[model samples]
Target chain A: MTLLTVENLTLEFDTDEGRITAVNNISFEVNSGEVLGIVGESGSGKSVTAKSVMQLNPSNSVYSSETKILLEVDGESVDVLALRGGKELRTVRGGSVSMIFQEPMASFAPAITIGAQMVEQLLLHKKISKAEAIKISIEMLDKVGISDADKRFKQYAFELSGGMRQRAMIAMALSTNPKLLIADEPTTALDVTIQAQVLDLMKDLVVEFNMGIIFITHDLGVIAQTADRVAVMYLGELVEQGSVRQVLKNPTHPYTQGLINALPKLDDLDAPLTPVPGDIPSPLERPPGCVFHTRCALAEPRCSESIPQMTNHGEGHSAACFVTAEKAEAL
Target chain B: MNKKPIISCRDLSVHFPIGGGLFERKQFVRAVNNVNLSIPQGSFFGLVGESGSGKTTLGRAFLRAVPITHGEINYSDGEKDYDLVDLPKKQLKEFRKRAQLIFQDPYAALSPRMTIRDIIAEPLEVMNLTSSREETDELVREMAHKCRLNLEHLRRFPHAFSGGQRQRISIARSLVSNPRFVVADESVAALDVSIQADVLNLLKSLQSELGSTYLFISHDLSVVAHICDMVAVMYLGQLIEVAPTRELFSAPRHPYTQALLSSIPNLDPDHQSDAQKLKGEIPSPTNPPSGCKFHTRCHYVVEHCKVVEPLLEHPESSHDVACHRWEELMNIKEIPVANLA
Candidate 1:
């Protein structure tokens, strides 16, 4: 069953100059107990779309008429966009759908103790007393491999190491037992050794909790390791969505192909970086036709004149591009 | 190859006095201790370590950004030689001209108010490298072009650029000085993987074109592996081992180096579990262990390793390792962990 469904989602920002389309019309569904990786470069609207699902977009962001997000909770479906303000968002934000940021320090309060913040969150979401909440928090901390849990519980965020702090944040996020965990570039800040450890822990947590996850990052290698399904976003549009193996092994979209080509593989150190020839056009000056047409190497006159809809190629494999899969492969 | 070493450090250490009051016994936080490195002329040398390893301090010590507390630092370029620890103020200024640094965060390094052209030309103006305004502009344009920055974008401020473009500006500013040596501390760490490759390639090409020596410092071993000709592994400010990049990755001598190399997440999905993950965090640098710093977490650490400090000993071709039981450990069959298949 689909745990969350986003349809015709459109988000705009009110800049000083004019209304800028940040996330153009996009639609996708995440099933229960599946990891979906959103791959894109900067200004690709991947982050904006993820934030929109939680209604965490800034005050200046203007939602278009077609924007709709339905969350299936306890066999009932409700529009997530209909919920307004902190009071209503609390049930969905941290209680049902938790979010972990890229930088652990940014999300964590430096002044407050990790234990204090974790217990406070537990108390707010669950009807638990202070003592019980503290116990669970410590247990969760231990589960994440933070040594001397009780001692660390009293220590402030600044005292813990980078790896420790990230683990603590994960523990705090898991303490609520949220069904949908949104990890945004979570391991990007960590060292390689620590990154491997954290990735291992996250993979284990997903299996134990059987939770659906939205893993957003620019690292294709990392996404390939963890995500079961992958979605490629470009210039505020969902360019492609399919299983990790299918999409990664045989990407259909020209933009997706370019992104995969650009990535440096460890197996082939000699491969020169063939970057998509142009820059990501600023959101204010988005291309008139296809968003990726400006950068697509195989782009034709028709591609520059019209936007292509997502065309299905195989089971759950779809892409938005003028060229066919075989033609794109030939390139 | 006949040119003298660009930078050489012997038993170099950078320590900070912790605990206040004159009467109180001064405890030192040895950020970098007993690190010996000889960076040859025009060589791309990599310094690899995690946090609290003193790689940043060592980089700063080359530029005299941080004070050298102990040992000797000898810098020479065939034409001249100067002791970094004892250089006079006048000579230090000249030394600054010879050695420059590039910071990691492009966002924080460049001033938002200054135009890209002005940002790149600031070093030339401040150091009086160029006499006329036109000369400075020419040099800035040259460096910017070398860094792949569009000439049109040079007129705009840093905020107008992306992370990759801003980093190019930072690179241009660092290279505009025409320094013989450059210390790049995690220059590509903040960038995305693809962008990182682009920047790394730019840096590599710059080194070749300018024929300048680089002290490349980073936490990412894969990057260091691919780029640097020589690799030095540091643990708590001490040089644990130094070897050729391919040799270091293929056959690491020190246990710490071995663990670090194995931990790098490869593109292959199958080989991640086979890595021998290091246990425990780096000990507090303020009150470091008296003996080998890595003994606390080393799986094969013996009693002797905890009691006596091991010096960097040469056992192979230009390869140096600081460990008590390296030979014995090397003899034992390695546990077959998943290789990055």
Candidate 2:
């Protein structure tokens, strides 16, 4: 069953200058117990799309004709987009879904104890007593490998290390046993060793809890390790989506190939990073044709005029490009 | 042949006292404890460690941003030698002009209120390296050209530029003073993978042209492996191993070094799940374990390893290890570099 389905999601930001389209007509589905990786550049609308899942966008964000997110709960579909206020959104925000952000420090309250926050979240989402909530929060912290859960329970966010704070945040997010977890650059702030540990913990939780996750990050190396299925986003569009093996090993889109090629290899230090030649077009001056046509080496004149729709290439693999799979193979 | 080391450290240590009270003696956090490093003239010496490994503190000690609690940091550029620890105010100002620092965050490092030209020229004006405005502009333009920054962009503030361009501006500013030794503290760590190469190449080219030594500090082993000639591994304020990049990767003598080298994710499909995962976290530097600091989590720790602190001993020319059981563990061959490829 599809745990979450976003269809024709178009979001525009009404700024002082003019209307800017941030996410443009994007659609994807997350199944139960699936880890979906959203890979993109800095301004690739990856975070915006993930944020849209929990309705966390700014109030100034403008919606187009149709932007539907159908979240299935208890065999009933809920129109999450129709949730007008925090009261209604609260039903899905923490009860059914939870999010982890890039900077743990920013997400956590500086003055309040982490345990209090976790217990409060648990009480808000579930019908549990204070004592029970506290017990559950401590267990979750222990599960996440906090050295002394009881001692750390009373400590503020500033007292914890970067890795510890991140773990605490994860523990808090998972305390509600949310069916869907939206993590946006959760490990970007931590070092590689701690990142690996957190990744392993997340994967373990996904198995133990049987929950779907939307992992958003700019690093493809990270996506490779955690994502079961991957989606590549470029400049407000979903360029490609497929199983992790197919997407990573045999990436069909030129942009995806360019990104993979651009990554510096740890083993082959001699190989130079072949950066896609041109800079990403500013969001205001978005190109009419393929969004990636400006930097694509294999772009044709046709690519500059017509926007390509998503086309299926193989099992669970699709790419939005005018170039055929055979031609892309030749490149 | 003895032109003297461009930068040398003899028992360098930087400690921070925390938890002050009557009951507590104010225990010291040994940020950089007993660190000894020697960077030859024009050599790019790499410092590799995870966070809290004191790599940044060590780098700052060289630049005099952080005070040296005990020991000596000697600086020599063939003509003059200065004991960096005991430099007088007049000589310290001169030393500042000779040694420069490249910060990690280019966004924060470059002033948002200043234009690129002013940001680059500020160093020159502050150090009194140039006399007239035209001379400053000429040097700024030269450095900007070398860094591949557009001359027109120099009129704009750092906000107008991307992370890569801002980093280029930062590099240009650091180079404006014409420093002999540069400490690039995770300079390229914040950049995109595509831009990291460009910045690294620029650093390499600048070194060749200027004949400057770089104390390159980064947590990314792969980035260091590509650019650095010699690599040093640090764990809990101590240097565990140091060797040529290729030699260290191929045959890491210390267990910690071996674990770090193997922990780098291999892009190759075959080596995905087989990468040796490092167990546990880095211990706190405030109260590090006795004997070998890494013994707490070391897989091969024995009774002797727990009781005796291992000294940094040379195993080969330009190669050093700080583990007592290295000779015993030498038989356990490291993961082949070709396997990752």
Q: Which candidate achieves the best DockQ against the true structure?
A: 2
List the lowest-lDDT window of 10 residues for candidate 2 chain A. Answer: A322-331
lDDT tens digits, residues B3-25, model 2?
45799998999999898898877
**Model 2 misplacement above 4 A:** A324-331, B1-4, B19-24, B268-270, B333-341
DockQ of each: 0.38, 0.44
| True-structure lDDT of candidate 1 | 0.86
Pairs that clash in candidate 1? B274-B337, B274-B338
List the candidate 1 regions with Cα displacement exceeding 4 Å.
A324-331, B1-3, B21-25, B270-272, B335-341
